[model samples]
Target chain A: MKTPLIDNLQYANFSPAIFEQMRAGGVDAVHVTIAYHETFREMVLNLERWNRWFEDHPDLIFKGTTAADVSLAQKTGRTAIFFGFQNPSPIEDDIGLVEICHQLGIRFMQLTYNNQSLLATGCYEDDDTGLTRMGRAVVTEMNRVGMVIDMSHSGERSTLEAIDHSTRPIAITHANPHWWHVALRNKSDAVLKALSGAGGMLGFSVYPHHLAGGSDCTLDSFCAMIAEAAARYGAEHLGIGTDLCQDQPDSIVEWMRVGRWTKGIDYGEGSASNAGFPPMPSWFNDNRDFGNIRTGLLNAGLEIAQVDGIMGGNWHRFYQQGFGPA
Target chain B: MKTPLIDNLQYANFSPAIFEQMRAGGVDAVHVTIAYHETFREMVLNLERWNRWFEDHPDLIFKGTTAADVSLAQKTGRTAIFFGFQNPSPIEDDIGLVEICHQLGIRFMQLTYNNQSLLATGCYEDDDTGLTRMGRAVVTEMNRVGMVIDMSHSGERSTLEAIDHSTRPIAITHANPHWWHVALRNKSDAVLKALSGAGGMLGFSVYPHHLAGGSDCTLDSFCAMIAEAAARYGAEHLGIGTDLCQDQPDSIVEWMRVGRWTKGIDYGEGSASNAGFPPMPSWFNDNRDFGNIRTGLLNAGLEIAQVDGIMGGNWHRFYQQGFGPA
Candidate 1:
């Protein structure tokens, strides 16, 4: 069987058209986050809406719990929607809430948004003390609940401390390596080693700002970076978390910049316009569809098997280990 | 200068005597789980207790967020304690709680305990569904918050999904490879490969049951396994997440058996405990002390630098990437 296309990561506004686009792209599954600055209640409402959307568009979307589910969805001509959270804000004070939300079908969770919180420090934190006692409790609880802990926007100290404290494997859902591009968003070689040592996965994002060449980046450059990482780490350890923010409203950008839905950060206002960055070339914008990732991989000279693994096989195998047929 | 003895994993009931022993053993740092099903709440409630303990026992313990912190602690005649969690229950449903807890010094988080939860599947679960929708959210929020996602007890699917979903590096705090012993408790070759691809860490535990020869297992046997993994994935991709449940009550055995705080698994409840299981051998029990890992590594004829990494240096470097400055 041909390896299915698995986009390990994506962040996009939901709509029927998008769902159809996902199906058109032959994307077996996509990791979708729900928690932002929205309150837990609001997040839940959104989750219900998405769940209902999936229910209404059964032909277009299927809820995925394992890699097998993605494969199954593909076989059945559907898109697997793997749910996640971009922020931990929804789970406010009670660590037990991690389990509750987890049970509710929120798969991936980032520890912070842009600013610091009670748990570990955030990427923007001027001072980071790593994970706190409650943060440690949250890690253990996450492990207990079988939730995947992510550290894309987290501060260095918190991320490392969380890695040490966790008894299981962890991941960096969508990030670039600092070795390729120096910035808070990029991970260091040491970090990669530690994560790989623990049997974790690193998903690369297609965010231009995080790229080595900045706004002047292209799919070829991205592929080169991935190839280098594969040479250093191995293709099996690498995958794609596209981090595509398609159909996202400008308000969402404002929310991201402000650090909260209602309040804004000191340095930036509503939305830090990306207009300064080179506009997405026509091909690139149209390529935002998940199918293009497969085409991109093929164009990069990646074998079909390799592409499959990066697209979804690796994730499927991973899911089998954690959540196979009971 | 001689490399300091660092315990990558340890879970002895905290006490002044233990701290003193660690100090006398020339230990540089330790990854201490702040949450366990048995003492989950106690650990959270007594955060100040640990902080106070570190404060009063400056000669013995210091808080650590990076490898440098451990080195600094060692230079200052102190043991660096990296706060960790064995579960994710503390965060409850709110992703924001991740940040809250991270701020308090919690560093690492394991996705599940022994059974199913909201995020992913566990090793003990009959069906490992990998990362749930909520699990994916946990991974994403963890990425944003900087908390490390751990999958030692997580099912295979969830582990891989977490790897695929994360944007930073991850870790497996404590686990043995199925290549060493094919048990649910062990990781598969594919999992290890994926982990290396992500540039993560694998902290091998000294759990007796996980050894090939069971109770007769020795430090040399453990080293052999580590060597095998290192040969396959490189030494830098390995570390130690010794699942030392030192000083834990017998209830812990029951807890481990059936995912209960005070009860055993239905099958384990009535059956006579396996002779080679549970209590482990006296040697293994006494060897739970973090200091012994170094001696055992030396006894197994590992290189000093290799031992240093397994002991804690590798983990320290990992922390530097995950967490920022202490």
Candidate 2:
């Protein structure tokens, strides 16, 4: 059996060193986001930089927007980099932009980051209106455009609505089930049911703040949480969206708190930052070098197929459906 | 039979002359949108203008955000102006912005204008993702913030999801059911059912492009269309959202076509424009001056109570549920 190792999601600040770390860790592929609240010019400029980097080191960075692309990259021993969006803000109010972004190779799109937008309500909103009229139209457009709708920061109503309205499977690219932790950021069983019932994927986030024990959460406890979700919503739809903000400065934390960059309500007051974990252990200080998750799963006696799906196969399948022919 | 006459929605580039016309025509109230894609500076400027205008003519302009406010305005014979939004783009990704705008007297909020945004998807998106994660959170926040969720330009997925996700009833502040006219801009019967089932309101738009006969549609035909919707969805949940873009410049049309203030794809080709109807015809052109819809309903022999609901009573109730007090 070809034991595949994939890191479905990570939000490390992009750098040459990070790329080198990913390559060194034998990481097969990762979804990289481009869209946020940045102006179109800024997004385009970032894309240009990414394109240059990929071109400069084809051995390290391979553009992948489909499951087949990831598989191909894995076979070639190159890390696949799937384009994604942390928010749909760049699309503005035009539904036509969905297709435009799809053409530009954005396979995964998180509806909102920390705040409310045109498509649906975000997690930080006091009241979740679910999906709006425009949000419904967006679901159809994403379906038509073959882009995977990721509801990591979405509100409950909007999340369920997307699940019902989507023609294909959706994904919670990074979220913890509320069962594991009762935070506004966590997904409820109803949400999990809706997502899985629609053949969608739920990428469990490894952020300590969202876990029940906060900073006290351990990798074993996190894996147990995943097992609980699997028991409830099936393992096929389970995956990982580590949501690792590695190499980000403390100023970035302040930016997120101010709702400037993250665009959400401040969660610092009551929530744990690093859960209870000590400042990033030496091996995982850089998310790119965090190879212990796979090993952790193996140590837990999970099957290779289950571990493979959790690591990357689920995300790979999701992308294949979103990006059309490999 | 006391047949009430009201304009459900209108976005007049307001002037003293327009206010004079509204008062002269015995118009009871108008839903005035304050939120567009304007920058914070522009929004503040517009608000200032409105504040000064209201202060200067308290007897003519009454601020409102709920059905009770409309009733109060009606009793006082003052034309109530309910603060509303055509798009939530001004709020951007900030969920707190909803409350800020709500405190500023904005009552109605459409998730998207004509395209994809962070909260919900627009009607024109090739694939409607319905509500984004943030969109859901926004809805919840809106509900908590006491702002009505409007789904005029929102896509199908977003609309249905919004209806399902909202703890309170939602509204399509301006729209036509697709069953009456198969335009992509209209809602389907299923969507209408979901919306109404959730105790939401459907404000039938009087735009010629959305009517069965397009530009050829007369006031009688427009009323007939409402009658059809009333027959199907019931008059209680059916109201008017005139969508009267009176006094708006041709440039606004051009902007709407490109999906943003700036240019991109032009989806407005062959689409109807208010140009031909400039000095708008009776009933819809200058909705305030047109008594034809009231006459048409009476001519059709509908009950005065039903007409009242269709005119503005239902919308008033919607606002009451969305925005407390006045």
RMSD per model, one decimal:
19.6, 20.4
Top lDDT prediction, candidate number = 2
Worst 10 residues of 1 chain B by lDDT: B261-270
lDDT of 1 by residue, B203-301 (tens): 887666666776577666777778778778877778877666667776555545554444434433124655213554444553335555567767766
Model 2: per-residue Cα lDDT over B227-252, one tens digit each = 77777778899877777777887766
Per-residue lDDT tens digits for candidate 2, residues A88-143, read: 87677767656556655788887877678888888878888888888888888788
Candidate 1 wrong stretches, greater than 4 Å = A259-262, A266-278, A281-283, A286-292, A295-303, A323-326, B1-326
lDDT for B201 in candidate 1 is: 88
Model 2 spans with C-alpha error above 4 angstroms? A1-326, B1-5, B259-262, B265-281
Total clashes for model 2: 75
TM (B chain), model 1: 0.87
> Of the true interface contacts, what fraction does each candidate have?
0.00, 0.00
Residue B25, candidate 2: how far off, in angstroms?
2.3
C-alpha lDDT of residue A16 in model 1: 87
